[model samples]
Target: MCGKGQLVTDLESGEIACNKCGLVSSDRLQENRAEWRTFDSESNDRSRVGSPTSLAYHDMGLATVIGKANKDSSGRQLDPSMNSRIQRLRTWDFRTKAHSSTHRNLLHAFNELGRLKDKLSLSDAIMEKTAYVYRKAQEKRLVRGRSTSSILAAAIYAACREMQASRTLRDVANATNVKRKAISRSYRILVLELDIKVPLVDPMKCIAKIAN
Candidate 1:
């Protein structure tokens, strides 16, 4: 037991405990925060215990993923014919989840979002904002036939400008391996169609971002 200890909620068990030592001090842990969390102008609170809403997944981490295994739950292999059937089911199942054109676009864009989030070393807030803007663009039919990577690069670039995260179009273009012109075009579409009101980032911030 550490001498300095404080109450820390075990997010998994919902038990309040000491931070230094994992000792439960209270049975009831309050879920109420002093203020509501609005990450990047969006409140992504899907009502589900243990599984919080996250931008990392195409379906906001809510889609049920069927495991890909030939073996059954009992660890016994299914009949070859049955395995074939299951394989088809699995493929269709994945297809069904993102059946619509908008959903399909989101799927690919989210995947690219994950890649750029890591490559650019972006924060969770930026990632969330990027996903939000992309979703809005999809809803507005702004990403009708554009490449997923290009659209996603534009969204991330807009998010950086909206949140003043110090990322430029060129930075996002390089990170996503998309052309700057494509990103800029999609970005303009996003800005106009979605009516996104992004405040101008400071000139000093731009200079600092370029220097970095």
Candidate 2:
């Protein structure tokens, strides 16, 4: 191994290697940086300094909230009339975000998804996939008369299956406090409506997941 101290890190592969020798020093590097992708020059400049937008959020995490501080651009306290107007603006801003029935449904479902994510220690990919599945269900009006929690749980299960993540329906049900039967029913509906082809679960991965 050439120890020329010329090291290169491949973010895609999460590996650190020596440039001269092509020897990988580390293979499991944890990437803690913000997930930023450049679609265009203008967008790249505008989005350089924030958490990446995500589908899990109802607004895709791009919506801004009016600050509660009753101050102006110069940090001066606003007049009573201006303060009152700002307050109204803030209230309407909050209401308009979830004004639609679909928005409200997504708000509730994503709240549950966040909770289950923490409880089950889900990966970001699985969470995004779950959100996508839930959104598709909503778009098809398949969520009518169904419990949001059950549907969200079913989405999580489907995402897990699709990603080969080794999580079971019972596990998702227990995490979401939804009945297994309900999740199963919802899962079937999602698959039928969305035409999602779920992959077969690997028993070895399941055993390893359970053991861990």
Candidate 3:
């Protein structure tokens, strides 16, 4: 049946062939099965290299590059992988810097969204919906070429508005670290894009919450 830890002894050879369901190396197995060893000890040398299911939110602008900010001449502040990350961050920074302050803030907001990407487990369909909303908003001049977060905020707000999620603009602003004015402008852009009314939570959403 090949059950777990089922031991079989070779009658002719006198050596035992262990069919243990473990990570132990067959070579490490002593002649006497009584002398047991943990399999993971042998596997300690192996290591995983990359995060396939991960996405990085490059918020650190100039600080992104290897030796650009506070690193040594060799550009070895972080790891070789960080080079690509820094490059991506710088690229985004460059693209968004040309637009209005609100646009810049929106780009920064996208950085935060990048972090939540894997954590929130946003489905590809939902992400596509988010993208669709952004494109629609862009056509209306609500948002365009901004960081994904700002665009996302507007998209979610639009989606929530349609779905009546009851989530407010202030909530989006606080979560995105974007100014209310910036969000408002983008929201207006959103309204213009979709040609539909979105009930914004108003600037009061930015007011300090009372603590008892």
What TM-score does candidate 2 reach? 0.79
lDDT of candidate 3 over 99-212, digit per residue (tens): 665455435544555554454433333333444566455445544465445666777566556533444677667666777677767666666757766555434433532321
- Model 3 regions more than 4 Å off: 1-128, 139-149, 197-212
Report every candidate's CA lDDT: 0.75, 0.84, 0.50
Judge candidate 2 at residue 180 and give its lDDT: 97
> In candidate 1, what are the lDDT values of residues 107-191, reduced to their tens digit?
7778777877667867666677788888877777777777777878888888888877777777787888889999888888888
Better of 1 and 3 by lDDT: 1
Q: Determine which window of 10 residues in candidate 1 has minimal summed lDDT.
A: 29-38
lDDT of residue 197 for candidate 2: 97
Rank by lDDT (best first): 2, 1, 3
TM-score of each: 0.65, 0.79, 0.34
Cα distance off (Å), candidate 2, residue 25 = 11
Give candidate 2's error at residue 135 in angstroms: 0.2
Error of 3 at 41 (Å): 48
Model 1, residue 171: distance off in Å is 0.8
